[model samples]
Structure formats: structure tokens, C-alpha cells
Target: MSEMRLYDAAGNRLYLNAEERAAFLAAARRQSARDRTLCETLHYTGCRASELLEITPARVDLSGGTVTLRSLKKRKDAKGSPRIVYRAVPVPPEYLDTLNTAHGLREAAKSRKKANAPIWPIGRVRLWQIVKRIMIEAGIPDAPHRSPKGLRHGFGINATVNGIPLHMVQKWMGHAQLSTTAIYADAVGREEQDIAARMWG
Candidate 1:
């Protein structure tokens, strides 16, 4: 028997590397601004699909540079009761602008109709379709976990490679356990090489 490999050299999951992520973002940019923002939000925030759908203008704190995500994963409290967890993830300045533009702040400033409106009004099915189309356009072919979750996993790998603290990543990603976020530590990157080199030096 041979050892089975689930993912590529990247890690356990099939996540987008930096180049693939860039390509995806570029392809998204070529689409409508709405699509661009939708893709960017998913990648930048590392949020789940359903959590992305819950984003409303009110939930967006532009001044704070954060997006509050409601984690859909059910967890138990001290009493063993189910509870929903919410987390505020920091948004890159450029991504924040993209979202603001997509939401039509100018119009909302006047009519206020779009103020409380959901950023992406489409349902989960439509959102998935849009993401799949973008993935194909970006030259990311079909594969297992090739949907939005891939993007989310990619964000985790990217963050880990960039030297962000694991606990912070856990908090930002709304993981119920730090262990879930720690798995990104296995992602192959310069961080691994640097740590290995220090031992020899």
C-alpha cells in the first residue's frame, strides 16, 4: 500500500496560492464591480459563504476597518447548549473601498435605501455560481473543494505565511478552537525554511 496524498505541496487542503489568488482577483476585476467586491470580500475576510451573505451595510464598520462575521458553525457553551459565535475581522483598506464602491455609498448617502441593504443580495446558490464562474475564468479548473471554501482556506494559508499570529488568525476567522487555525502552520512557505535554517545556524 502507498501513502495517499490529499492535497498538493501547499498543505492538507486544496488552497489557492498567492499567484492563483492574484489571478482570481484579476479575473474578478474584469467582471462587474459587484463581482469584484464579492470575490475580494470572500478572499480578504476568510469568511464562510453563509456568513458573507449576512453582511449588511450596518455591519460594515468602515471607520473601524472591520467586518463583523457571524460564525455559522454550531458550538457548545459551558452548559453544553448550542451558541453562535461572532467575530470582527480586519479588512484591508483597499478592500474596504471596493466594498463601499460596490454598495453605491453615494446613492445610499442620499436615499438611505441601500444603507441597511445586504451588500450581496443574491442567494447562496447564485453566489456559488458567481464564484465558480470566476474560478473558471481565473484558470482555476474544477477540483474537490474548488469553491468558496478554497478561497477561505487560501486566506488562512496566506495569513500564516505572512507571519500573522495563530491566535489572531483564529479570532479573525471565528474558529471555535485555536487548533483549527493552527493547522495552517503546516503550510509550506518561507516561514518553514527560515525556521529550519535557524537550527543549522
Candidate 2:
């Protein structure tokens, strides 16, 4: 891969700001239970849309307060066999509660058949549309950073701004290289300013 950038060639931002992120979550709440949890999962975990869709009931560890996501971007191992890399990202306990109430997660996980199946089970095209609709509902203007990728990038930046260690963000984002996670530290905006403010205080 060349590199991961938070901007396109035209210099439009490829990540949502703090306010936009909050708006997206607010709009996500207006969606149906399944869709709301889907959107919230993307927001909280910083996982790719495909990774979010790939999550199964068994992977949601309520007791552990984490969600195990298969890192789709990391495709192969050194020997060229398919590498199924799993990362357990910690999520808010409240999100877990909502997920359980909405999907009966604890119940589904008890059965082997239901545990292995994907939670969302929707195609990429449909999921994309749902995300786009939520963006509009959030009143986020048209921009390069208006899709699920934006949400993932936003999570990275948000975590960095909130003083979460860089290494932790790297693991949460499933970045193979720590350098890739460093990109979020380069993000500038009000959030960064707030971090700087603490120093001046």
C-alpha cells in the first residue's frame, strides 16, 4: 500500500470532526434497532464497514467488554496462506447492552449455528446506502469524509485527541504498522487545539 491519508488529492478531509462524529451517532440512534447498533458498532470500534458486517454473536464478548473483528485489510501471512487476524477492541458497556437487547446476543451466542453467522448479513451496497442515509440525516454536508471510512478515521483522531496512547489506538484500529496509526496524531482541528490547551493551562 502506498500510504493511508486523511485527505484525497484535492485536499478534502477524509475524516469527520468531533461535532460531525457526534451528529452521526445522534442520527444513528434514529435508525432501527439492528441498523442503529450497526452504525454504533462502526462508530465505537473504528472497524471497517466490512469488518463491522463480519462480526458474529460469539465475537461480542459482553463480559470482556470487547468485540473481536477480523482485520480484512491484513489479508495474508508470510507463507501466503490466508491470515485471519482478529483484534478485540474494547467498547463501552452501554453499547454492549444495546446490542444484546436489540439482537439477543447472549442468547444467540449459546448456539453454535447462530454464533458463527454474521450479525448484519447485509451486502456492501446496501450497507453503504444505509451509512450514506445516516450521514445525510446527521446534517453532515457532502464531503470526501462522509462515509464509513470517515467514521473509522474519525475514531482514530478522536482517540488520539482524548489522550489514548498511540499504541492502543494502533491495536484498536488494527493497523499493521504503528506508523499508519501515527497519521491520526497529525490531524489538526478544534480537537487538537483542546489538547494543546491543557498544556497552556
Candidate 3:
């Protein structure tokens, strides 16, 4: 059965630790620009793969230093129509520079028609392959968490560990409930230790 824990039902850790995340980023940077942006965007934003795929040039706000993503989970109203929700998450300036350089986002963003095009044109399965390949290249151990979802989980934990508010994490993650986002606050052992160390210091 599924649980509200970071680990899977089989007890596999579902999020990458700091060292693993850093390794994954190093490996990602060695790849081509397209793959690098895809990997880095996922790393920084912690958005789901499908949500990443939906992003167009217009979605990237270079000046504002944020990427707006369309949330995949459609909440229906009383009329049963799916509501489209969007969330904007901040990214680094260098990440924005690389994304603009790789995809010509600035020029594309100028036109409504051009801006609507997806940044990464590949499908979900192909996207999964790219991330998994990067994970292997990073030398992350073989486990249930060695996929894109792991990266997402890592973002949550990293934010929590670094002292971001849970409500803000929930907003950035586009979670429907604060309870869902609260799980990251229950980080284990080493992560807890890091937070404790800061307190003790």
C-alpha cells in the first residue's frame, strides 16, 4: 500500500541526498544544452516531468527569474470542469541565461505564436530516459528513487532542510494541501542533523 512517506512501499529512499543531487547536477551539466536545461529545470523547480514538458518559451520569465508551470493535477469545480492552475517558481540567473542561450527564449517570447511552442519537444517516455541516463552517469545507486520523481522529492527535502517555509514549498510544488507538503518537514537522520547543527551553532 502507498504511504505518505518519502520511501516507497518497499522501503526504498525516494529522494536524493545533497551529495547525490550535486553529483546528478554535475553529470547533467556535461550533457548537451537541451538535456542540461531539462535536467536543471527539473532540479531547480522540482516540477513533474509532464509539467515541465508543457512549458513554452513564454512561460520562462527571464527578467523576473522565474518559470511558470501549468499544474497537471486538475481540480474540478462543482460543474465538473477541470480547472487550469499555474505556479511560478524562481530559478537561478545562470540557469535562465543557459535556458535563453540554448532555446532562444527571448526572441521566441516576443511572439505569441512562437512563444506557445514547448521548450523540450520530446514526449514523457523520452524525457524519462534522459533523466534516468543522467542519474546513472551521476553514479547514483540503483534504487526506486533514482528517477525524475526522486529529483522532485529532493527539491522538497532540500527546501525544507534549508529552512524554507512549508506553505511556500507547498505553493511552489503546486500541492493541493499543506499536509502533502508537510511530509518534507519530517526529513530523516542526516537531514535532521543538518538542521540541528544550524540550531546548535
Candidate 4:
């Protein structure tokens, strides 16, 4: 009958700007400490929603300032065997603090116990609902692709624009290929204007 439009029709600009990011985080924070940490984890680590849900308190290493994320994306080695990749993403101590507060556990306790305890303790559908609610509260207009995936893309593009090394971004993002991470380099933002000004001056 008719072609269905299941995705965004306006444009392919999936990355959120700094202001939008901040607004979304602010909205998330108002929801709960758990949500704030969840959104912060997504923003900082660029992990997929599934990976975020897979996070356990034991996976968080506060001393090392990193969280170990198990990649959910399907990957294959040269031998064509499936590979389960894990990445450790550096995060600020404040993000860990929120996590502790949400779970009501200290860092030491988190490390010594709760190996199987999920941090967010929510399913995929619930996580999506939380993200969509936060986006709405932040006044972000509804769109076909305006969801948690957009947050992940925004984190990647934001990192590239801020001059973070592409390889490092790829690792933090749990991307299988550097070429996939390189797409962030094509995102134009304030970084473009600043570079242009330096050249023009």
C-alpha cells in the first residue's frame, strides 16, 4: 500500500548539541539518582543501552577511574569466530559517586560484593522509556530516531569534536572498527567554527 516511514525524516543529524545534552542530563537527574547515573554513563562511556544495563557494581573500578563494559555488538575475528569484546572506559569519580548513591553501597562494598547485582536493574524496554521521558522533559522534539541511540552517537561526535583521539574514542565506544569511529570526524559543530577562525586569523 504505502511506504512506511519508521525512521527520522527531517535529517540524519542524530548527535545532540552540548546544550541539548546538558538539558537531557538535567532532566534525567531530576528523575532519580539512578537515572542520572544511567544517563551520565551513557553520555560519558558511549555504551549502548544494553551494555549499560549489563553493568554491575563490581565492574566499576573507582580507584582506576574506569568501568568495564561488555560489548553487546556482534563481532567476529579473522577466523570468523564470534568474539565477546570488553572495553574499559574512563569515567569521572562523580559518576561513580552517583552510582554508589543510587545503589546505597560504598566503593569497597561494591568491589567486595554485588558481583551479580546489576547497577540499573532494569530491562531494555524500561531503559528506553526512561531515556524517552528524559528527552521529552528536556523539551527535545519527538523524532523517529530520537532515542538512546542518539545519545550514544552524540557522545561519539562530541568526543571527536573535542579532539579526543579517534582510536581512544573507538575503544571507549566499544566500536569494532576505527572506520566506524571515524564517522564522528565528519560531524560539524563549534569545533569547525573554531578551526576556521584560527585559519582565518
List runs of model 3 lying over 4 Å from the truth: 1-4, 78-80, 188-190, 194-201
lDDT of each: 0.80, 0.91, 0.92, 0.79
Question: Residue-wise lDDT of candidate 2 within 7-84, one digit each (tens)?
Answer: 899988899988899999999998999889999999999999989889999999999999999898856788988887
In candidate 3, what are the lDDT values of residues 44-144, reduced to their tens digit?
99999999999999999999999999999877767988898899999999999999999999999789988999999999999999999999999999998
TM-score of 2: 0.92
Q: What tens-digit string does per-residue lDDT give for candidate 4 at 1-201?
A: 233221246654566766678788888778777787888888878888999998887788877889999998788899999998999999888877777777765544535556657878889999998898889999887764468988887788778878899999999998777877877776645447755787799
Model 1 poorest ten-residue lDDT run: 1-10
> What lDDT is obtained when candidate 1 is compared to the true structure?
0.80
**lDDT by residue (tens digit), candidate 1, 50-130:** 999988777777878988888988888999999888889998888888777778654564555676677888999999999
Which ten-residue region of model 4 has the weakest summed lDDT?
1-10
- CA lDDT for candidate 3: 0.92
TM-score of 4: 0.84
CA error at residue 25 for candidate 1, angstroms: 0.8
| Clash totals, every prediction | 0, 0, 0, 0
How do the predictions measure up, each by TM-score?
0.82, 0.92, 0.92, 0.84
Q: Rate residue 40 of model 2 by lDDT.
A: 97
Instruction: Please list the residue runs of candidate 4 whose C-alpha ends up more than 4 Å from where it truly belongs after superposition.
Output: 1-10, 105-113, 189-201
lDDT of 1 at 177: 75
Q: List the residue pairs that clash in candidate 3.
A: none
Clashes in model 2: which pairs?
none
